[model samples]
Target: MIGPAALTLLLGLWGVTREHSMWRDEAATWEAAHRALPELAHMLDRIDVVHGVYYLFMHGVFAVLGDSLIALRLPSVLAMAGAAAATAATARRLAGSRAGVAAGTAFALMPSTQHYAQEGRSYALVVAAVAVATLILVTLVDGRGKPGVPARRWAGYAAGMLAAALLNWFSLLALPAHAAAVFMAHRRGATRLLTRWPMAAAAVVAGALPLILASRSQAQQVAWIRPLTWSTALAPLLLLTVGLLCADLLKRLPATPPTPRALSAVSLGLPLLAFPLLALLLLSLIKPLYIDRYVLYTNLGLGLLIGAAASALVRSWRPLVTLALAAFAALLPLQLDLRTPQSRVDDVLAPAEVVARTSRPGDGVLFIPSLRRDTAEVSPGSFTALDDLALAQSPSASGTLQGKETAPQHIRRAMLGKHRILVVADVDGHPGSARDTVKRRVLVEHFTRCADTEVRGRRVQSYERGTSCTAPPLRS
Candidate 1:
């Protein structure tokens, strides 16, 4: 009953959470998905990505849904619900009905879980698969090493793990933790599992090969032109872990009697907290890819541990503690999502709408190279809202003018044919040499700013060709 109720609540929250705008990354995914199949393949090959499977998945998703916000985000919400249910079922089997219900509830209300659930990418799907795989692995390990642990069960778990790896490369980070848990569960059975490592590693390699080739061929695109500091990357990870800890506390409350509260709490919390940290330390020792979303697979352990603990605590203060912690976890995220949109990465509708409203039909679209520094290149039909317009590729270097040095002749030719042009550029600060002599000479000599407009919060400079503008900016 608690499990079903918790599932219901999580599903309800999904409806409300879906109401926000898309961030830059979601726009990128949509742009890639909406491309023609051949072009899409080319694009993926050219971009350094560990998750090419998402591009293929979104391609199918958009084919049916028509690229709307609801269309983009619905799959993620469903995936999250699946994850919540799986977590509950797994927790229930390992602990008890009380722990199972609490785990599901805790997961449903988690800010990070909720955050990704509303996205349009592969994280939610990966998390869902991870939960299912975790459940199967746990079942296999926790059950007495009876000869009856079906081969089909192991096969199913392997498939899920492979699929997860394909969906998001970060899912690989959880492998060591999962393997350690499995080995500990059936010490003797560990030898058999070890025998299967060759097969498992092969599947992972096969699944990841496409992404690897795509990355090598296309080169990874970095949105941040500047190097990122360790501090900036670490801050989000720390904050996310703290949020998960608080939610876990709520999940550990006791439901019915006959459960030893203190003993259960320690048993749950120590393993939940310890294993992930150990995993992180191990990863850091070799090479650290400390992204928050990458760590999401392990979140199941935390949710389960907390649920078990909360069930234990429920022996004393049942309703109040349960409700308070649940409320606290749910409220912060709800408010943050509502007031500050973009908490979920896949809400691309509002930003796309902004692009549509600001530009006009036949007006030339200009993308300033500096703006590209933010990992957001305008979507394929970014100009569709305004008009069926041709685009002028701007210089990607910071503070550089479009058509500076390399493309003076091209810009010169473009200006001769297209008189009405909008120069679009993101003005966010990036450290690079200022506008070079070529751009300065071209702007001063050939074109003059006619009207200025802004799209998606960037300043666009409209330029008209001067009758006396004869020589190309580069030649000048």
Candidate 2:
């Protein structure tokens, strides 16, 4: 049962492994990891991004794999696969083999997990690490085998907890919730272990210190999410926690057994499931830092809670048929949506591709107004930069008539030094400039607008200063 469930998951993941083209964030990861160590460090110092561990991990990944879309996302794929396997094991530990099978199978089909697995980001990897850590913690909490726990297992869990916290700061919250859940499950043993694991607790505090200090510095970068409102605050917490619970519960009913004990077990689990989600909801109201994927690590717990709930509902063949039809109808649209990810890469390809093909590997490719996280994601190996500029407002380059004020002089130095230049802007989306304003002002001077170039569903107007002008404007 375990082998087939894991195999089915691997096969399903293989299907979406290369579905979407490489988007911008994935590109940034490739660029960062592929560069010299010193160069990567210098860039990190400038940006307020606190993804140092991810940067370092990708540095090694890129060293071995080179920078291709498949290579960039391979780590995430492997991590999601690990999470699937771990979910199965964790379920078996918590419930029984039938429950474990259901949990693993449901995890493999989860749209959210599948979505992250296909991207080249740290979330999926973090999810896997969190799952392992959660499993270890749960084992300790549940007092599965130990009348008194082994020293080595305690040490191993201490190390794993610290590793999970460092991997993604948000999982720090998830880890504690796991400990709390374990305590609720086995109060006496968990209490004794907590007292014994003082050293482990100390290690966690020490490991989190860097993240604590870095949080102050990272304040400005994520300021966009602050000043929480009631609706915005509650929405993400509910979505991350309850949403997964509901999805998993619905997905697992087909395998449930109809018995009173099953119903009683589910009833017992509900409050245990809802508490931390409520805590997150309250915290979000105060801080407004909630994001749907931030609590992604909890999806493992959610899968189990859901599977347990479904297992409770199973009684007869009639209930099984009804549950299967309902689950299929509900998840089919979601599955289709995930199987076909919205390709921002397709949308923004016009200028990126044109620059990619035309520019030499060493040549500078500058974004007039600084690129978004997505646009900044283009491969550094493919297009070096003279200066990567983010304009304060768009429509005109700095110093242009349509622009707010003076463009930075440093930009002129970079532009003039480069042998040629390529300019790209979404006709409607470019800031400070209306569609016509961009065409009339910025596109005319440094770059001549190409006849046919469109990116990401928007018309991609391109201008070139030094190169031959054979390329046409990108079209839809």
Candidate 3:
């Protein structure tokens, strides 16, 4: 278990978290943590409610460790590793040692797991809390060979559940899955679960209500998550299938009926894997919240289910080796891709660096929608020579990812006064605002495009005052 958990952390630490540039949201995380606690709370009241707790946590991390990218993302790496260990522990309790190790390995190897393992955000912490809560639930139920849960253990379960819910309000969905597990484990009476689970479940829900309400009012933050299409709708099932296959394929699956313990694990794992996904899909029919990361905790359930199957199938070391080799063969490419700088929506540093290197001292930089200026936030002095044509207030003053924007007319006037400008924009520029259109209009109508280049999912270009604008001189 320790080995697998260590492997996960080491793999996440390998290259990318530090090397890849911060994206917009990550820039948000970085900026929020540098504020005074009261200021951070005020910012949370209006925006980024979903991430407030995470920001607070990162604030503490930054206070001590300072703000290197690795330091910023280290908490997530540790949380993911803890999630793997908890997954292993839960699987071990439900099945045995072989299943536990297999489960942990599967979790560490998941590309989604790897992706979030290095993020400086709430999702990995949410997964860790849920995994630990599930482990506690298993302990409370199984009691090794005893019949009932102790008060101390029940308290622990409540604490764990509360932590998970606070980390991400959507993790409250785990309540129903936990109820299903308890019912399956104690189906003969369910009196034990009925007596204990409700108090904890209610506590978690109650505690998360403030965050849920606050985040709800800011729903526009997720306006980008469109109504699900078929392929996106099928993703959870595909992930579940992949998890099971990863384990079961190296050795033959069991033909015999599962024992009561195995049945209990299956019940818990099934709901963990399915309920959140189903709930998200159903909810999206109303308000569209179907982003995949929201349900990332389901991967642990998949690992447990597959580990249980693998335990039943593998009686020897050869089969275990075969499973390990098979998993490596399949997940290597995903691991490689996860480590790439282009793994995110874009390399934010590209535009920052391009603008820094290309623009002249008096040049202006125009960020369509203005918020895109966060691309340069990662490096404070990187674009200081160039004026930000649309910035009204700095992020520090406004307590936001992008800060306040200048009016379109002011932006136009500012732009008209500059002879050279650097432009950084999203590739398609979807959801362009009226102001964004005006900014684009001013640039194209008055300036010559000296150069334009695509950086993964974003575009970086240079422009100059018309007529006098000629091909840029060559440099060695």
In TM-score terms, which candidate is top?
3
Q: Which of the two, 1 or 3, has more TM-score?
A: 3
The lDDT of each candidate is 0.57, 0.56, 0.79
Instruction: Give the per-residue lDDT of model 1 (tens digit) for 1-476.
Output: 34533553455355543455556566667666766776666555445256567878888988977777677777787787888888788777666777777777777766677677766778888988878877776666554435666777777777887888888765765666665554554453444554453466566667776665665553334333334356645654564475356445645543434542212222333344445555554465455434556666666766676666666666443683567466766586574654245344233344344445544566554344433322223343665433212224322221111223334455444444554455444445232433323333455467666555443344445555675323222210
- For model 1, the stretches where C-alpha displacement exceeds 4 angstroms are 1-20, 187-219, 222-230, 233-288, 316-321, 324-326, 333-362, 370-408, 412-420, 427-476
Ranking by lDDT: 3, 1, 2
lDDT of 2 by residue, 18-104 (tens): 444565556556556655676666555544245667878988887788766677777887787787777777666655655565566
Q: How many Å off is the CA of 465 in candidate 3? A: 1.3
Ranking by TM-score: 3, 2, 1
After TM-score superposition, what is the CA distance of residue 123 in candidate 3 from its true location, in Å?
0.9
Off by over 4 Å in 2: 1-12, 15-20, 144-148, 186-191, 197-199, 226-280, 315-330, 339-350, 356-368, 372-421, 426-428, 432-452, 457-459, 463-475
True-vs-predicted CA distance for residue 346, candidate 3, Å: 0.8
Residue 187's C-alpha lDDT in candidate 1?
Answer: 55
Q: Which of the predicted structures, 1 or 2, would earn the higher lDDT when compared with the native?
A: 1
The TM-score of predicted model 3 comes to: 0.92
For candidate 3, lDDT tens digit of each residue in 325-427?
A: 7987898888887777677877677777767777778788878656777787776677878888888988767767777887889989999998888888888
Best by the lDDT measure:
3
Among all windows of 10 consecutive residues in model 2, the one with the lowest summed lDDT is 259-268
